[model samples]
Target chain A: MKSKLIIYTFIICLFLTGCFKENQIEKMGIINARGIDKQEDGLVQASLVLFQFEAQAKDITKLVKGTGNSTKGAINNANLETNFLLDSGKLQIELYGKETAQEGISPYLDTLLRDARVPDTSYMAIGEPTAEDILTVQESGISMNIGQYLHGVIENSASDKLFPKVSLVKFSRLKNDIGVDPILPVFEIKEGIPKITNIGVFQDDKYVGDISIENKILFNLLDESLLSEWLEITLPFEPFKKYKRNSSSSTTEKLHVALNTLRNDSTIRVTDLEDLTFKINLNIEASLLEISNQIKLEDKRVLKLLEKEIEKNIEKKYEELLKKLQEFNSDAMGFGSVYRYSKKGKPLTRAEWRKKYPEVKADFNVNLKIIHHGETF
Target chain B: MKITNVIAPGKRIRAFYLFFIICTVQLGVGIMGAPSYIFGYARQDAWISILIAGVALILILSVIIYILSQYENSDIFGIQVDIFGSFIGKVLGSIYIIYLAMALLSVMLTYIEVVQVFIRPTMPSYVIGGLILILVIYCIWGGVKVIVGVAFLFFILSQWLLILLYDPILRMDWSHLLPVLDASLIELLKGAKASSYTLLGFEILLIIYPYIDNKKEIKLPVFLAIIYSVSTLLITTIISIGYYSLENLRDSEWTVITLFKSASFSFAERLDYIVVMEWMMIVVPNNIFLAWATTYGIKRLYNIQQRKSLYILCSLLLVSISILKYDYMILQFTTIVSNMGFWINCVYPFILATLVFFKKKRSKHKGMNTT
Candidate 1:
């Protein structure tokens, strides 16, 4: 009787297993990238680059555009248009146009963040002209497709210290962290071709403008409190300047100088309630890359002049950037976060930061050290 | 007679009951929310903390086994009464029973909240509560052996569904895990505290100990069950950390559940349905085990029969508590229960071991003096 029951149970199990066989696919529509922009009709225009499965063959990438009042609505509309469901979990990149991002990505981000379908680590970028332009970028000569190209651009920029790897998850944290403003990869269309050029800066959710053209932005910022390793930018020095030469050169000689990032290591000394001074050390390690007017290769006097000029340039840039930050009331440099995290437990909210940031006195000290040159003249 | 009658099971049921107990108790409500909670405190290192917790569980269980072995065939109740005189022993037993009841209530409430919030917002809490209660009653009515057999079947089936989760794991970015040694000590501690849920249901050994035929083999299976649970939790943590990074996992409420939904199978777009469906296999036996434990506790403490009286009392309490407190109040209540259960389960085992040892020492000394 027991043996009979066992066999009977096995048959029932096999039948039940067939009944509940999951309708799972061997391949799924993987979204590689997404672009969001605003339309003239006040709808959010979303373009998705989907990596389509091609059985036994390499995956084919396709673009699908949907429009609605919001990103979620647009995505829903797009889903309705396709036989295959839209899956954003594999999405590696998301591009928001300058105007759309400025309008506020918080709403769109809310939809993605709140939705379980969207992966949290999707890299966020800002596009110029329109997100659609970047999403539709196609070149006849390009070996890799547009989705791969766009992803490659962000990856290359990050590797070159051009911008930070700003994941959607990290953006949300930095969005809320006091004093540390968020930065994203920014793409601009030049001559109708989309290219990621600068880092899009944001104060909370609002676009605060990218870092000025001079100082290279690292994809991940080093702790501003420590004077660790800094980037060294070498340039040519003028002959008339009081400096030593790294090498003998034509009056217009190139200087092989190393410039370290020091404004990053600026100190925030909170003396009293009334005075919060940010003493910036524009400490740069430099040498001559070239010289327009130079003396001898081993002339310490000539090299000093080159170092002084390098010092002056760094200090000037630091001051200008600080002034711009004060003007914009931006804390992207992380002065606010440093203050809040460093000193005790009390954290200043957005309101408190706005009030105190302008009154803050920022002192600049440019320290120059002529470390080495590429070779003797 | 009562004990033998309650423990009787067909040979086939023995394997299934054990499997059911292990899988259901191990999976519980923790799998849904644990990654986020543990991640928040430990940051990326939460996975490390889970592995550490698993080891801690193994050690705790080993100690429990050692204590049980001292009495040979006696269980926690019999040992307690023998060691501490009946009055104090019964009081301690009552506390244990009440603690299990409270824990059962908390797990039931947690499952309800998860279902209401994620699966069905419009569905009443009692729908889940009523369904679960019916299943638990049916399992217990069939007796322990049958329940274990069912658990064994569920465990084997659920393992099949887990293969579908591999797609998301492949896309994991390990770079996001940089700056590894970053979390504050306080945060790591908080993460360890949140891991209490993952380590739940192991305490059911207190009741299940007497039912096992071979006391010697008991240690290995129980230890292996803990190891299995820890391995599952560790895998879940690694996947959550790999899929979302620490920052994202920290902010998410139902991190694992969300991750499951994020993937699309070629045949079906809805992976969340599969997850919720599999969770039924987990929740059913888990709910039944907790109910059985509560009933067992009552039987031991008050000298009530295992059937009819103890089971009915537990059913009434679980169903009413599960139904009546369905809203936000359930959240407040569960936090207290989980916090209390952690103390009762993790620490109480040690206390019993100490008490038993002390009594044995005293008796040995008296015998020596008499000689």
Candidate 2:
């Protein structure tokens, strides 16, 4: 009797297992990328890059667009045009338009946070003018799906340490964290192709300004400790004129130098509490890669002079960038975090830090070491 | 009522299995959300709160073991009967049984709710609840030895999931843990009090004491188990506080599960989904042990057989889980159960241990006078 009961129970369980709603892969529209833009009339528009599985199709992806008052509403509006059920579980990236990002992204991020299906690792970026244009671009020489392609672009840059990787979770963490603001990579149509051109700075959730691509490495050096990479710096020709071995006359006013950085580490300290001043120290170990003016790198004195010049140049540029960020009222460098931790009393609030951020002063110290000038030098 | 239980020699288990039993029972649906709940009070100092709770747990476990040592082959129900006499002891024992039943129901409902939110939203609650209860009934059929075996097996199985926390640990912002000792003493105590929910299940030792073969050696395993469980909670809480900002931590419902959501592998993209499904191994042992305690208590207090009480209690739990389908309703039920569990599991033991101590002293005095 007990064996029979066990058999019956097993059979019942088998039958009950089919009660769950089945979602077949072919019948669902797998959303790879989502883009949101704000319209002039204050409505939200959503553009989704969906993976198409038709064997005969030349392209395996397509874009669907819709408009509504909210992000989810806009997505649901887009859902009406497709035969397959739209599923965002496979979403790899999310894009925001310049205007929409300027308005703020916290409202759109709510749906992402509330939904359990959306992965927190999905990359977040801002389109230069509008998310729809970037999502709908038909660039040549790109055979893969556009969404996948965009994800690869951002992922490569992040891995290379050229741009900070701001995933859905990281973005929210920085936005909500006291004494720190969020930064996102900005994409724009350069000529005919979509490209990540700059790093967008945000005050809270609003896009206030951007750091140009040329300054990306410097920005990264200030942001976090980085691995091996290449950096190009230009110095005054006057400093190295005497050391030039060939005495080659050049019309250029500045000497260009390229260094392959093996490692860069930065530390931020609150040096003065009353003056609200912070001191940033950078330690860089690099191998000389290129030089506009050939100098005797074999000489110890010349190498020391090169290091000193490079340090001074980097320090000057860092001061400029810090001033620019102060102007924009964005503490993307997380100076507030260091200040908050150093103080003993009450925790610093975001609003209080924002008010004090403009008056904050910083001193930059760069220690540059040319470990080796490659096999040539 | 008999004060000492007489068991078949074959039914007894080694004292070492208490480690597995206590550890598995303490780690349930509670640890998944314990970080967020405790973080609400202690902030980054939540680990300190867990440490405080651990020390208190060790003291309480020692006292409970002392009380059990005062009698031979006696469990909580038997000792209560000795101290409070028949009627009051039965009433108190029945209340404990009811608490266990409520705890069992809440665990089932919470797991169902998690499945609904994370995996299949449209699936009915009764299906999951009924399925789990069926497994519990099957396990309970094998008796206490089988329950302990399941606990040991599942404890070994579920420990590998701890390795998944490595990815989240890498992304942690060390600065978030700064400004330590920020929470006041009162707040830290309150945080420790909040952890009582997750730190429960060791109370099972009170009833399962009589079934151990080497009763004298039970202390080492039991203490080790509490330390293992508490340290696990402490580690997860510390990781969560560092991985998420204060505001983000506050917003997250299940911080540990969310931590897994960000972990991606080359072969598997959504690890959280796998973790959620694999969590059944963890949840089943909890249900089995709690169900065993409830039914065993019923059998001891009343004359009803364990099998009959198991079936009736499981059916009632199925009905309750189905009725408490809404998220808010499940949350409310969980709050009520944890509050009740706090008092019965943490506070009541000290009171009972004191009563047992004084009763033994008076009985010794009476015996001396009679001689």
- The C-alpha lDDT values of all candidates are 0.67, 0.88
- Tens-digit lDDT string for candidate 1 (A1-377): 99999999789867864543242443556678889998878999899888776566563777888998888789878877665567675677888888888877888888778765566556788887688887777655456656677777666642444555677766766776556677777877655455667667787777768765344432232322223334444465444434444463445445544443333433444444447777655444444454344445466776576567666666666667767777777766666654554454443577888788877776667666666654754
RMSD of 2: 2.0
lDDT of 2 by residue, A291-357 (tens): 8877889999999999999999999988888788898999888998888888888888888999999
Q: Is the docking of candidate 1 incorrect, acceptable, medium or high quality?
A: incorrect
What range of 10 consecutive residues in model 1 chain A has the weakest lDDT sum?
A: A218-227
Individual DockQ of the candidates? 0.12, 0.80
Displacement of residue B295 (Cα, Å) in model 2 is 0.3
Question: Alpha-carbon error at B273 in model 2, in Å?
Answer: 0.4
TM-score winner? 2
Give the C-alpha miss distance for residue A77 in model 1, angstroms. 0.9
Task: Judging by DockQ against the true structure, name the best candidate.
Answer: 2
Off by over 4 Å in 2: A1-17, A158-161, A247-252
Error of 1 at A45 (Å): 2.1
